[model samples]
Every structure is written in structure tokens, then in C-alpha cells.
Target: MTETKTIQKTFWQKYSTLMISLVVLVIYGWALTGLTFSGIQESAGEVSSSIFHGLTHPDWAYVYDGSGEDLVSLILQTLAIAFLGTVISAVLSVPFAFWAARGKNEGKLHPRSTTGKFMLVLIRTFPEIVLAIMFIKAVGPGSFAGVLAVSIHSIGMLGKLFSEALENMDHGADEAIYAAGGTATDVLTLATIPTIMPEFLSYTLYRFEIAVRSASILGMVGAGGIGTPLLFAIQTRSWDRVGIILLGIIIMVTAIDWLSGMLRKKLV
Candidate 1:
């Protein structure tokens, strides 16, 4: 009986916090439900049926349009934004990563490391939309704003990932290089970079994939891409054009995902 009581006490001790959290979440969810309308709008069924009809009958012309401002061209613009953003961000992240990484000259305890982390946090605090808006105001709307926003946001992510990769590297090579009187640059090129290259490439490719999606969405804010046209179609109730644009987006994203997946698998 004593042992049974001890087990019961231990179970309650282990689960008490979790139970309390669940109770809080349940109460919050119940409160939210009260704010929802109890009935659907009368036009809901009509709107749904119209959307279904539009999706079923997408505009084939838009799908294959090559007239400079067509779906294909817009998609290509989005691709460019994603590609350039990833490249710029990857290049910019190198110094930040080296600074923030533990056990380097600017390791975690160093002032430079703290500064690097602070910069990364500041960059990451704002969403891409906010960054895009700022860039739009600074440079005017177009793919330029989208590219800058993606690059800035990606720097924060790539910096953190790159730093972790560097920190996790085998330090024995670095130690050996240092013992052999190799300079910092020599050690980095011969020991550090070689060890972390695969991870770095992997992270870059992953960021590129994310940038593609972000580029598409950035167009909604007039940053220039298929998203702008898609939004226009929705606003104009041009269901056929929306369907075509959606298809193009789906195809583009899928192709990138497949390509990136294969490359990542090879790296791993």
C-alpha cells in the first residue's frame, strides 16, 4: 500500500504541470468558440460552388502564355528572387556564422559573438512582410523589394544554422593545424570549411526552398511575382485565371521541392 501511494504521488508530480497546461488551453479554446458566428452566411454555398466550377475550368491560355507578362514569366521572376536571395544571404551569413560560433576566435563568450547574435535576433524579429514593406518604401515595389526582404530574413536563419554547423565540427583538425603553425585563414580553408561544407550546402539549399515560397507570397504585397497576378484574379473574381495561376505555382514549388530533396539526400 505504501509503494502504491508513492507511485501515485510520483505520477501526479510528473503530470501536474501538463494537466494544468491542458486545462488552460481547453478553457482558452472554449472562450474562442464563443466568439465564432453560430451560423454560416447564406452566400457561402454559392461562393463555394462558384470556386469549384472555376477550379475545374482553369484558363489554358494563361497556363501556356509566354507574352512577357504571362504566368510563366511571373513564375520565373519569383524563381529569380528566391535564387538571388538565397545566394546573397548565404554569402553574407559566413562572417556572422564564424563570429557567433562557439570555440572560434569569436566564440560564445566573446563580445563579437554576442554582437553577432544580437544582430541575428534583430533581423529575425520582423516578419518578411514587414521587411518587404520597408524595402518597398525604400526602393519602390518590384522584385527588388522581394529579393531584399528574403535576403535579410534568410541571413538570420542561415547565420544561426551555419554557426551550429561550425560549432559541431571536429575540432581535432583545427587543433592540429594550429599546432603545425598554420595561420587562421589556412586553418579555416583546410580544416574548418572542409568539415562543414556539406552541412553548409545543405542548409543553403533548404533556405532556397523556403525562399521560393516566400518569394511567391511577397508578390501579394506588390513585390513582383505570380502572387500579384493570383491576388488580382481573386479580387476580380476571375476564377479561371486564379486556377491557372494556382496550377503554375503548384508545379513550380513541386519541381523545386523534388530537386532540392534529391540534392539534400545526396549531401546527407
Candidate 2:
């Protein structure tokens, strides 16, 4: 009986608050939404009937019908923009990351000093969508605008990643190189870069995947890609075309995922 009471107490202690909170939240949600179990039942019935009447199979033949050429071109353009943007970002971030990781010194101006930190913070504060909009206005609409937008945003992101990687690196090799009369450049090339190379590559690949999706959406703002077609489909209420476009996006992302996974596996 003592053991039974202990078990009961433990069970209540674990679940009593959860059970009470669930009941309270349900009551409050129902009050807010003006919905009860009966109302949900009625709504579910109506939705079921509507779905049965409206649902239709896709026209798979339409996928192969002449749209393939246009789709392929748009996809290639998106890839090119993503690739170029990622390359530019990676290249620029390297020096920025190195500088940003350098801590404050008494006599020297450090890269991670107040001014540098503030600048990085400011750059990172703006959303990528906002940057994309600004670039669209500044450069006019095209893939170039999209590429620039991605590149700008990537600088902030890659800089942060690189700085973190630098901070976490084993400094023994760098110290040893310095002790052996190596210059700062030699120490960075021989010690720091080798240690952080894997991390840099991984981050770049991940950003490339993100850039691909961003480039596609930039087309919505007249930046050129599959998003233009997607927008058209939406405006015309072409569900079939929308479905096909979504499938294409899924395929492209999956390919990138598979390729990146393989590369990361080899890299790590």
C-alpha cells in the first residue's frame, strides 16, 4: 500500500499540471475561436464533402509537354545565380572572418573592436528579403540583382560562421608556426586555414542550398527564375501548374541535398 501510494504520488506530480493546463488551454482556445466539439464536427463534415467533390487527379502528361525546356532554363539560371553568389560570399568572408576573430589589443586596432563589431551587427540586422528588395530597386530586375542580394546577405552569415570557426580552432599549431619564424601569413596558410577548411566548405555548401531557394523567389520581384512561372500559375489559379512547379522545386532541393551530403561525408 505504501509503494502503491508512492507510485500514485509520482504519477500525479508528473502529469497533474500538464492535465490541468491542457484542460484550461482547450477551454480558452474554444472561447477564443468560438468553436466547440459540435461546431468542429459540423465543419469537418462540410470540408470532407467539399474535398470529395473538388479533388481531381493531376495531368501528368502536362509535365512532359513543352514546359520542360522553359523549366530547365529557369532552373539552370537559378543554379548559376546561387553558385556565383556563394562563390563571391565565400571569397569575401575569408578576410572579414579573419579580421573579425582578432580580439582587441592595447596598441593595435583589432578587427573585432567596437567599430568592426558594430558594422557586422548592422549588416546582419537587415533581413535578406529587405536586401533583395533594395537590390531590385538599385540594379533593376534580373538574375544579377538576385545574385547581388544573396551575396550581400551571405557576407554577414559567412563572416559570423568563419569567425566562430577561427575562435574554436586549436591555436597550438599557429603558435608553433610563429615560434619557427613563420609570418602571420604563413601561420594562417599552414595552420589556421587547414583547420577551418572543412567548416568553411560545409557552410558554403549549406549557403549554396539556401541561395538556390532565394534565387528562385527573387523572380517574384522580377529577378528571373522559376518563381516568375510560379507567380503566373498562382495569379491564373492554375493548381496543376502550381503542383508541377512545387514538384520541380522539391526535385531540385533533393538533388542538392544528396550532392551536399556526399560531399560533406567525404570532407568530414
Candidate 3:
């Protein structure tokens, strides 16, 4: 009888969190019931079949026809866009990162850090596609617009990452420099930068991987890359061309990821 009583007493302790989880699941199920899915498109079958057939039999000749619009040229352009955008964002993110990062003496709930986080949240929440469209209007729809969109969109994430790195970084080097009567610039260059540059470069390379994919998508909006021609091929029902473009993108992205992973391992 005493064992039974003890089990009863411990029941809530063992299952209270589980009961809360069940309640959340029920709430999610209720919310999902309100969603109404539309019927599939009538042409979806034919389109899917064509896409698959195209994939199996890609236009090999499109790989290089000496046309400036070939896959090789556009892939290079995409890489260039991602590289430039990532570099620009990395440089511009420094001030924002410093501003957002909490100082060593600051409390967890400091107003400055709170405001900076909120601002970064706003920036991160804005859609890159919308930014691309807005920039397209200003820049007349080209690779430059793509670059601008990526640069601005990337700052939100990069700043957050950089600030987090700063906040968690070891203070030993900084303290040592100060103890040695180092000037502010001396501390910054000799202690801070050397200590943090590797982290910054690692994050930048990861962001570059994401930027490459984004650059390709931006090309769909006439931002200038392989995606522009890929879209055209799709619209014209040129599945073979689509196949070749997809193949090129796959190869290019894979190569970049491999190279970046190697570089990051060294830098970090």
C-alpha cells in the first residue's frame, strides 16, 4: 500500500511535461484542421513526366556551344555574385556586430542589446525576394541588383552570428593586451582581430554557400544568371535545356561546397 501511494505521488513528476506535450499536439492538430488544401493542377501529371524525361536525357550539346549564354559563363557569373555579396556583407557586418554584442559588464537584459536584437529581427524577417524585386526596379534588373539584394539580406544573419561569436569569445588576449599598456588600435589589431578573424571567415564561407543558392533564385527574377535561361527554357517547354541547366547548377554548387568545407576547416 505504501509503494502504491509513492507511485501516485510521483505520477505528476514523471508525466506533467508529457501531458503538456500532448496538449500542444492537440492544439497543433486543431489548427491544422482549419487549413484547406486545393486540388492538384490538371497539367501536373504531363509536366512532371516531361521533367523526368528531360532529366534522363539532358541536352549534352548545350554544355558548350561557344555562345556567351552557355552554362559555363552563367555559372561563373553566379559564383561572382555570391562571392561579392558575401564579402560586402562580411565587411559591413562588423559595426553592426559590435553594436549588437553585449559588453562584458552589461547585464543580460540590457536595453542596447535588446534594441539591436529587435532591429536584426526586423532585418532577418524581411523577404529576400521582396528586396530583390525592389532592387531590380532601382538597378533595372540585372546581376548587380542580385548582388545588392544578397548583400543587404545577408547582413541580418551575419551580424547576429558575428555578435554571438564576439560575446562568447575568450577575453584572455584582450586582457593581456590591456595589461601590457596597449593602445586601443593595438588591442583591436593585435588581440581582437587575430583572435576573431578565423571565426568571421568561417561564418562568411557558410553564408557564401547560402548566397550561391540565393543568387541562382534571384536569377529567376531577371537578376542575371543561369536561372534566367533556365526559366526561359521552362516557359518554352524546353525540358532538355532545363536538364542541362540543372546539371550545371548541381555540379557548380557541389564543387563550391567541397572547396568551402576544406577552406573553413583550415581557417577555423
Q: How well is each residue in 48-101 modelled by candidate 3, as lDDT tens digits?
A: 999999987999988887887888889999999999999999999899888888
lDDT of 2 by residue, 1-268 (tens): 9999999999999999999999999999888897545545647777555434333433344455565446666788888888998999999988878767754232235534445545667777886667777888998888888888888888888888887787677888888998999999998789988989999999899888888888878888777777888888778756566666777777898899789888988876
| Best first by lDDT, ranked | 1, 3, 2
- Candidate 3 lDDT: 0.90
* Per-model TM against the reference: 0.90, 0.74, 0.90
lDDT of each: 0.90, 0.78, 0.90
Off by over 4 Å in 3: 1-9, 16-21, 35-43
Model 3 clash pairs? none
Models ranked on TM-score = 1, 3, 2
Question: Stretches of candidate 1 above 4 Å error?
Answer: 1-9, 13-21, 30-34, 104-110
lDDT of 1 by residue, 55-97 (tens): 8899888855568789889999999999999999999999999
TM-score, cand. 3: 0.90
Residue 50 of model 3: what lDDT? 95
Off by over 4 Å in 2: 1-69, 103-114
